[model samples]
Target chain A: MLLLRIASTHVRNRLRQTIVSTLGVALGVGFSVAMASLMEGSQRDFMTTLIEAIPHVEILDEKRNPAEQPATALYDAVAFHGLRPLEDLRGIRNPTEAIASLREWIDGDFAQRLSGQSVLRYSGQDIGMTLVGVVPGRELKVSKIREDMRAGSFEALDATANGLVIGRKAAERLGAELGDTVTLTSANGIAKRFKIVGLFHTGITTSDEGLAYAPLKAVQILLEKPDIINSISVRLADINDATRIAARAERQLGYKAVSWEEANEGLMEAFVVRNAIMYTVVGAILVVAGFGIFNIVSTIVHEKARDIAILKSLGFPETDIQQIFVLEGLVIGVLGAIAGCGLGFGLSSYLATVKFEVTTDIEMTRLPIHFSYVHYVLACLLALFSSGIAGLIPARKAAKLNPVDIIRGAT
Target chain B: MIAAQPQTGTDTSPLLQTRKLTRILPAVVPVTLVQDVDFSVGTSEFVAITGPSGSGKSSLLYLLGLLDRPTSGEVLIEGCGTADLSSAEMASMRLAKIGFVFQFHFLLPEFTALENIMIPMQKLGRLSAHAQLEHATGLLVDLGLEDFLHRRPAQLSGGQRQRVAVARALANSPDLILADEPTGSLDSAATEQVFESLQAIVETQKTTVVAVTHDMDLAGRMQRRVHLVDGRIDYDRVQS
Candidate 1:
C-alpha cells in the first residue's frame, strides 16, 4: 500500500523524466526482442532445412581417424539373423552378421533386431559410395532421399538387380540417365555396369551433385565386398529420442553414433555464433538504456532532496522513501517492457511479412523475415531487470540522506 | 544556583522533559552551542524558549521535539526515554505524539495543503482513507485554510503555508506541538495571525506547546517563558 502511494506520487511529480526513461528502456527492449527473434528464426530455419535434407542420426567411426570406417559389430549382428540392418534392428554389428544374428535371435534365446531394414555398401574406383540397401516400402524414412526422386519409382530396387538412382547433377556430369548404362569402377579397380533406373535432385547443391543410391546385393557383388557395409542408418520410433538411441547404439555396436548436430558441426557452430553476436549487439543497446535510466533517476533524487527531507521529518521511514523511488523505477520498467513487447511483436511480425533481397555468390533471392516468441519474452525480461537494477544506486543514495541537513540546507 | 523543584500540582509525568540538553557545533574545537539545560513542559501548558541569535533556542526546541537527539542528554516523552527507542519506534512515537513546525513552512511543494496535513496521520497508519480525508479537512477548516486546502504550497502566501504546516502538525492530534520560530519568516501581520491560530489550538485542544522565538512579544504572551544565555537558562518565569 505504501508502495502504491509512492508510485502514485512519483508519477505525479516526475512525469516527463518518467516518460523519457520508459521510452529509453522500451527502445532497448524492442531492439533486443526484434534482433533475438531474427536470430532465433534464422537458427530454427537453418536446423529445419538441414534436418529435412538428411537423417537425424548417422553412424560414423569412433576412432576419430578419418580413414577408419565405423565398426561393423552391431551391423553384423542384425545381418547374421537374415534381417536388414536399417529396417528391423534398433542397431547393428557387422552387416552380414546382423542378417545371420536376426534369424537366430528371433528363435528366442537372444534379443532380435527391431525390424528388417537393409544395409549395403559398394565402392566405385577410388570413389566410395555407401550403398544404402533400403527396403523398397520403407525408403521414405530416409527423408529427401525419396522426395528428390525425379524419375522411376523407389520400388525399382525391389524388382531389378544392378539398378541405380543417380543424383541429377551426377547424371548430368556423367552423361547418364534413366535406363542408361554406367560403369562403376571399384576401389580394387574392378569395373561393373549398372542401369540408372532413377534420377534424383536434393535441392542442396552439394549432395545432389555427389550422392547415388543402389540395391544392396548388386553393389556388394559388383564391388566384391559382399556381406560388408561401411555403416548402418536406423530410423527411431521417436525422432526426438535420437540422441539417447544413438548412445545406446554406440554402446551395443562398439562404434560411433552421431546425431545430426554432430554430423553438421560447422553449420551448428555458425548458427550459435550468429545468435551470440546478435544478442551481444542487442545487449549493448540495453546497457545504454540502463545508463539512461540511472542518470534520470539520479537527477530526480538530487532535485527532490528537500522534498525527501520533509517527508522523512514527517516520520516516513527510510525504507518507505526508498520504496517510492524504487517504485518509480518499477513503474517505468513495467511500462517500458510492456510497450517494448508490443512494439517488438508488431515490428517482428511486419518484418516477417517483408521480403528483403539478399545476394550471395551461390544465388540471389528475396527472403522473408521471421520471428520467435521465446526471444520476445527474453528481451522484455532483460529490459525490466536492467532498468530495476539501474534504479538501485539512486534509491540507496536517496534513502541514506540526512533529513535534518536536507531540510535546513547544511545546518 | 537554587535548584528548581518539580511541581506536584501538575500530572506527575510531564508531556515533554529534557535533562541537560546539549548540542555541539561541528568545528575545530567543537564549539558548545547549548549545554546543561533542563526543561520540561506539562500537559496543556504553552511554554516559550526565547534567546538571541546563536543562543541555541532552536537547538533546544529540536531536542524537545525529538527531531534531533541531544549530544549528551536524555529526552523523555511521557516518561519514556527517547534514547533507547529504535529508529522505527522513534518515528512512530513522533508520529503519534510530536508535531513540528519550522520557520520555513516546510510543506511539500507538490502536494496540496490537505495532503500535507494528511502526512502524519498516514504515517501512523491508524486512519481509514475516508477518515483521514475528513480529519485533514477538519484541521484545514480549524486553521482557517478550508479554501486553500487544494492549493499547493507554492501557490500559497508565506502566512498561508505556515498555517497549513501548523494544521498538518496538529493533524494526528499529537500530545506536544513544537514550533521553532514558526512565524520568523512571516510579516508582522502574518506573524500575529499564525500566533493567534497556535494559541487558539492550544486553548481549545489542551495541547502542550513549546515554541522557540526571538520575538519577545510572542514569548511574553505564553504561559511561561525561559530565556537562555550561552546555552544555560538565565531566567525562567511563569505568568498568570
Candidate 2:
C-alpha cells in the first residue's frame, strides 16, 4: 500500500507528462479499434451481398468423380478409346421424393431446376442463350429473381401453361416482349413454343443478355429428359447451416453440393490476409505507444533519484522500490485504456453515419463499422501488456541505484 | 543534561560493534574510503565521530548503518555477525533496530511532515494504520512541532525539517540512531534546537546515539568521542 502511495504521488506530481503519455496510449488504442471496425465492416458487407444473390446451398446433378470405363481403370499407362454407351439421362430421377425425404430434417425451401443451351427464334430474329427451367412458385422462395423482375409476375407462370421469363436485354435482342410467343430449340433439335410471361433486369451482363426461364415440366419434355431435374436449390433459415447441410445432403443424395462460402473461396482467402495485416498494424501502433510510457517512466526515475535514495535509507528493500515504478506504469495504462475505449466508440459511431457512396452509378451505402466488446477487450489487453513491460525497464534501473553513491555528496 | 550522567550500560555485549571494518571504492583507480576500523558503543552511550573532509567519518557511519557493506571484516548488532545475512535480511534488521538522520533532512517533497514520519513504521508493517498515525503525531508533539505536522518539508524552516527528520528516524523505535551532521546545514539557532532534540531522545528514551560531525563544539558535548584520521581511529575515549 505504501509503495502504491509513493507511485501515485510521483505520477500526480508530474501531471503534464502523465497526461501526454496517457494520450499517446489512448490515441493508439482508439485508432486501432476504429480501423478494425471499418475493416471488419467492409468484409461483412461483401459477405451479405454474396449470400443475398445466390442460394445458401446448391445440390447439382454432377458427380464428384468423373465416369471412367472398366478398361481405363485397369490400365495405368494405356488409355482405351471410343467405347460408346446407350443414351441415359444424367439427373436426379425422383426429384420430388428426394426433396421430400430431405425436408424431414432440414428446415428450408427447395426448388427443382433443369437447364440447357438453346436458341430462341421470335418473328425471324434468333439469339443463342442458356434456358433454365424452374417451378415458378417454389423457385421464387430459393432465388432473388423475384426482386429482379421488371414486368409480369412469377406466379403467372403457374396459370399460363407455356410461360417463359427472359431478361430485359435477352428479350430485346430476340425482338420479343411480354405476351410474345417464341420458339426455343434445344441443342438436340427438339423445339417448343412458349409465351413470354415476365421480364427481368439483373445488372449482370451474361444473365441479362444470355439467359431465359420457363416452367420445369415443359422444358423437361421439350429437352426429351422427362421426369428429371438437374439441380436442387436450397435456402435455409440459418445461413450458417449451409456447409453442414450441404455435406449431409451430398452424402445422402450422392450428388455434389456447393455452399455459398465454397463458391467464393478466393474472396474469403483475401479477407483472412487482410485481417492478419490489420492486427499487425494495430499491434505496432500499441508498441509505439509503449515507447511513450517507457520515456515518461524513465524521466521519473531520473528525476526522483534523491527520493529513491531516501527510501532505500529508510530500510525499504530493492523489491519494494522496483514495485513502486511498475505500479505507476500500470495506473497510467489503466486510465488510458478507459479513455481510449470511450473515444473509439464515439469515433466509430460518427463514422457509421457517414454516407460513403463513391458515385451515384453504384448502390448508395453508409460507412460500415462493426461494434463489439471483443475489440475493446483486445485493445486494452494489448495496451496493458505493452505498458507493463515499458514500466519494468526503468523500475529495474531505479531499484539497482546505489543509495550510498547518491547520498554521499548530499551528506 | 536532564539530570542523567554519562554512563555505559553493563550488559555482557555491546549494542553495536565493528571488527576491523574496511571499504574500497573499487572504481577504475580504486579509492580506499574507510580502512580497517574497530569500534563499539554500548546502550545509552552517546558517541561522536569527528574528522576532517574525506577522513571517512561518513563512510564509517554508512558501514555501521548497513547502507554500505564492508569489503572485509564485519559489523555485529547485539554481537551477531552480519557478514552472511542477505541484503533483504539486512534491510529488515535495519528497519527493526536502526535509524538514520542525514544533514539535508531528506524528507520526500510531496508528503507532509506527519506522513513522512509514518513511512518507516509503514515499511516495517508491524503497526496498524491508526496506531501509526497516533505514534507519528505523538513523535511530532514530543519534538515540539505539533503545529507543523501537516506542512511539507519545503514549507517548514531548516530546523523544523531536521526535527521532522528526527521524528521519522524514531518512527519504528529502533535501538540505535545514526546522525551524519544532523545540524551541519542549520544556522546557530536551528542547530541548537535539533541538538537538544537528539539529546532528549538519548536521555529520556535511552536510545544509543552515534553522530558524524565536523563541528567540534557539538562533538565535545557527547559522553564519548572517536576521532578518525585518514580512515583510521586516532582515539576512542570517554569525556571523563
Candidate 3:
C-alpha cells in the first residue's frame, strides 16, 4: 500500500516524463508484435505453397545391395513376395526384383483406389499427351490434381483400353483436348495412340504446363515395360505426422520414403532464416525499450530524492522504497504492453484486409496478413519482463539512500 | 550566585541520560566536535543547553536524539542502553519515546500540517489510522495549530511550521522532546509564539524538554540551563 502511494506520487509528480517513457516502451512492443505477425504469416504462406505442390509423402525404390547375389534374381524375388515382375524385368536374367515386386504390390492392392492416376510417355521431342489410367473415383487426394480439373470429367481406365488426360499447357502445345487422339512415342521407339479424355489447368507452373496423366497399366504398355511404375505417392490422415508415418511406411513396404521436409528442405530452411532475422530485429526494439525504462526510472529517482527522505524519516523500510520504484516501472510496463497489444492487433488486422499484389508465378496474387495468438502473448511478456528488469538498477539505488543525508540536503 | 536545588518530591528515574558523549568530525586529523559530555534530564523537567556557533551544541543534541550515534560513550533513554539497539530498533525507540524539532523545521513540504504531525504516530504502528489521526489533531489543537492543520509547511508561516513540528514531536506522547534551536528560523514575534507553544505543551503534558540553543534569553527562561563550551560543560544553573 505504501509502495502504491509512493508510485502514485512519482507519477503525479513526473507525469510528462512518465508518459514519454511509456510511449517508448509501447512502440518497442508494437514493432516486435508486428514483425512477429509478419514472420508467422510468411511461414504459413510458404508451407501452404509447398504442400500444394506435392504429396505429403512419396515412396521410392530402395538402392540395390552389391553384396547380395541370387540366381533368377528378378523373378525369384518377385515370386517370393507374392508379386508379378514386369515383362521387361523377366527378360533380364538375375536382375534385381525388388522394384518389380513393389510395382506388383501397388497394382494388386492400390490400383482400385488410384483414381485420376496418370502416366506420360514422352519422346525426345519433350512433348507428350497425358495417359490417365485411373480407377473411377480415387485420385483427387493428389496435390493440385483435383483442383486442376477444368474441362471434361476425369477418366476411368479399363483393363484393356487406354485413355489420357492432358493439362491446358499440353493442349496448347499439341493442339489436343478432350476426345482428340494423340500419338505418344515412348523411350523404346514404340508409337501408340491415346484419346484425350480430360484437360485441366493447375496454376502451378511445373504441374499444369508439363504434366500428363494415364492409367499405370497403359503407361507401362506404351513404354513397353508392363507392370512397372515410376513412383508411388501417399496422403495420410495427419499431415503433420507425415515424417513419422513415412518412416513406418518405408519399413513396411521395403521402399524409401520421403517426407515434405526432405522434399522441400531448401524452402523450409529459407523460412527459418527469415524468421531468425526478424526475431533479432524485433528483439533489438525491445532492448531499446528496456533502456528507455532504465532512463525514466533513474530520472524519477533523481527527482524524488527529497520525497524519499521524507518517507524514510517516517520509518519506511528500504524494501518499501525499492518496491515503490519497481511498482512505478511495472505500471509503465503493463500499460505499454496493453497499448502495444491493441495497436499490433489493430494494425495486423488492417494490413490483412489490404490487398497486396504479389507477382510470383506459383502463389496467390494477394497475400493476407496472418496473426498468431501465441506470438502476441510472447511479445507482450517480453516487453513487460524487459521493463521490470530495467527498473532494478534505479530501485536498488533508491533503496540504498541514507535518510539523514537526504533530509539534510546532502544530495 | 544561585544554588542548585534538585526537584522536590519528583521521581528519581531519569527520562534521558548520556555518559561522556562525543562526536568526531572526519578529516585528516579528526576533530572532536563534542567530547566528554555528561547530561541527564529527569521526568517533567525542561533543560536547555546554550552555546555560541560551532560550539557543538547541536551535535550533542543529535547524539542524544539518536539521530546520530556518539563516537564514544553511550546514550541511555528511559534506562535502556541505546548503543546496543539495531538500526530498526533505534528508529522504533525514537518513534515511540523521543521527539526532535530542528532549527529549520524539517516538516515535509508536500504534506499538510496535520499530516506532518501524524508521521511519528503512524511510525509507532500501535494506533489505528483513525486513532492516529485523532491523536494528531488533538496534538495540533494543543499546540494552537488547529486553524492551519490543512496548510502545507510552505503555506504556513515559519512560526506555524515550527509549532506543527512541535505538535508532531508530541504526537506519540514521547517521554523526551529534543529541540535544536527550534525557533532559530523564526522572527522575534514568531519565535515568541513558538516558544509559548512549546512551554505550554511541556507544562501540560509534563513532557521532559531538552533544547539546544544560542538564544541566551530563551535559555534563561527554561527551568534549568547548561552552557557548553568547546564540547564541555562550562556552567550549569537553575532559575527560580
Candidate 4:
C-alpha cells in the first residue's frame, strides 16, 4: 500500500513528463494495433479468395519416385538402378473406384478433371487457351467459378450438346458470343466445333483471356484419351485437415496427392515473412516508446535523490525505493495502453469506412480492417514489457545510490 | 520488548556502544573521517556531539544509526554486536530501533505532514493501518501541527516542517534519534521550538537523542556533551 502511494506521488509530482511519456506509449500501441489489423485483414482476405479459387486437396496421376524394380524388391539389390521398364499410361487408370472409395470416407465433395491446351478458330483468328474437361455437377461443388459467369451458366455444359464455357475475354478476342459455334483444335491435331454455352469474367487477366471449360466426354473424345482423368480435386469440410487427408488419400490410392498449402507453398512463406516484418515494426515502435519511458524515469530518479535518502533513513529498504520508481513507469504504461486501445479502435474504424479512388471488379473497394480483441491484448502486452524494461534500468541506478552521499551532498 | 536483550556487558547495558569505531574515505589521500573512537550512551540520555566544521561529528552519529559502515570497528546495539550483520539486517535493525532528523526538513515534499510521520510506522508494520493513522495524527498534534494535518512539506513553515520531522523520527518509538544539526537552518525562534520538542521527546517519551551541532548553546543544553577535535575525542563530560 505504501509502495503504491509512494509510486503515485512520485508520478504525480512530474505531471508533464508523465503525460509525454504516456503519450509516446499510447501512440506506439495505437499504431501497432492498427497496422496489425491491416496486415492480418488483407491476409485473411487473400486466404479466403485462395481457398475458394482452388481445391483444398488434389490427387494427380504422377509419381513421387520411380517404381521399385522387381529384382530390387525381391532380392534387396543395391546396384541395379540401370534396369529399364515399360512406360505406363499417364493418367489415373480407374477413377470410378477411387472416387467411390473417397466418397465413402471423405467429408466433402470431389471434381474429376482432364485439362489440356487447345487453339480456338473463329473469324480466321487463332487464340491459344487451356480447356478443362469437368463434370458440371461435381465442378460446381468444388469451385466458385459459377459465381464469375457473365452470361449463360456452368450447368449448361450438361444441358446442351457439345457445349463450352469460355471466359468473356477469350470470347471477345475471337468475336464469339454465347450460342456461337467455335472450332477448337486439340494438341494432337484433332479438331471439333463446340457451341459456346456460357461466358465468364474472373477479373484476373490471365484466366479471363486464356481459359475455357467443356463437357468431360466431349474433351476425352476430342483429345482421343477416353476413360482417363489426370486429376481429382477434393474440397474438404474442414480445410485445416487437408494435409492429413491428402497424405491418407495418397497412401490409400497410390496417387501423388497435394494439399492446397503445398500448392501455394511460396505464397504461404511470403505471408510468414510479411508477418515477421509487421511484428518487428510493432516492436520497434514499442521500443521507441520505451525510450521515452526511460528518459522520464531517469529524470524522476535524478530529481528524487533527496526523497530517496529520506526514505532510506526512514527505514525503507533499497527494494522499496526501486519499486517506487518502477511502479511510476508502469503507471504511465498502463494508462497509455488503455488510451491506445481507444485510439486503435478509432483508427481501425476509420480505415474500415475508407474507400479507394480506383475500384476493381473483384478486389475490395474499402480497406479490409480485421477487428480482433487479440490485437489489443498483444499491443498492451508489448507496451507493458517494454515499459517494464525501461523502468528497471533507472530503478537499479536509484537503488544503488548511497544515502549518506546523497544526503551529505544535498545538505 | 519481545526478545531477551543481549547480556554481553554489565548489568546496565549501554543503549549504544562503539569500540574503536573508525571510518575512512578511500581516495588519493585516504582521508580518515573518524578514527579509533570509543563512545557509549546510556538509555534516555540527551547527548550532544560538538566539534568544529568537518570534525566527523555527523559521521559518528551516522555510524551509530547504521547509516554508514565503519572502516574497521564495530557498534553495539543493546549489548549486541552490529559489525557482522548484513546490509539487510542492518537496515531492519535501523528501521525498528533508530530514527533520524537532518538539518534540512528532509520530509518527502510530495507527502503531507501526517503521511510523512506515517512512513516509518508503515515501514515497521507494527500497527494496523488504522492504528498507524491514529498514532501519526497524535504525534503531529503533540508537535502542535494539528492545524496543518494535510499540509505538505512545501506548504508548511520551516519550524513546522522540522517539528513534522521530529514527529516522523518518533513514529516507531525508536531507542535513539540520530539528529545531524536538526535545527541548523531554523531561525532563533524556530530553533527554540525544535529544542523544546527534542527535550520533551527525551524526557517524556524516554527516547535517547544524540545530536551533532555547532550551536554551543544547544550543546550546553544537552545533559552530556562529547567534544571532538580533528576526528578524536577531546572531552567527554556531563553538563550541569
Q: Pick by DockQ: which candidate is best?
A: 4
User: Candidate 1 chain B, which ten residues in sequence have the lowest lDDT sum?
Assistant: B1-10
DockQ of each: 0.48, 0.67, 0.23, 0.73
Model 1, which residues run further than 4 Å from truth?
A59-137, A147-163, A171-181, A194-205, A250-256, A261-284, A357-377, B1-11
* Order of the predicted models by lDDT, top scorer first: 4, 2, 1, 3
Clash count in backbone of candidate 1: 38
**TM-score-superior candidate, 2 or 3:** 2
Could you tell which candidate, 3 or 4, scores higher by DockQ? Answer: 4
Candidate 4 lDDT over B1-240, as tens digits, reads 012233466667799998888899999999988888898998889999999988899888889899888887788888888877766788888899998999999998988999889888988899999999999999999989999999999999999999999999999999999999999999999999999999999999999999999999999999999998878898999999
Q: Is candidate 2 or candidate 4 better by DockQ?
A: 4
TM-scores of chain B, in order:
0.93, 0.94, 0.92, 0.95
Best by lDDT: 4
Ranking the candidates on TM-score from highest down gives: 4, 2, 1, 3
Chain B TM for prediction 4? 0.95
User: Residue A184 error for model 2, in Å?
Assistant: 5.7
lDDT of 1 by residue, B87-171 (tens): 6677677778888888899887768998888877877878998999999999888878889989999999999999999998898
lDDT of 4 at B99: 89
Q: Comparing 2 and 4 by TM-score, which wins?
A: 4
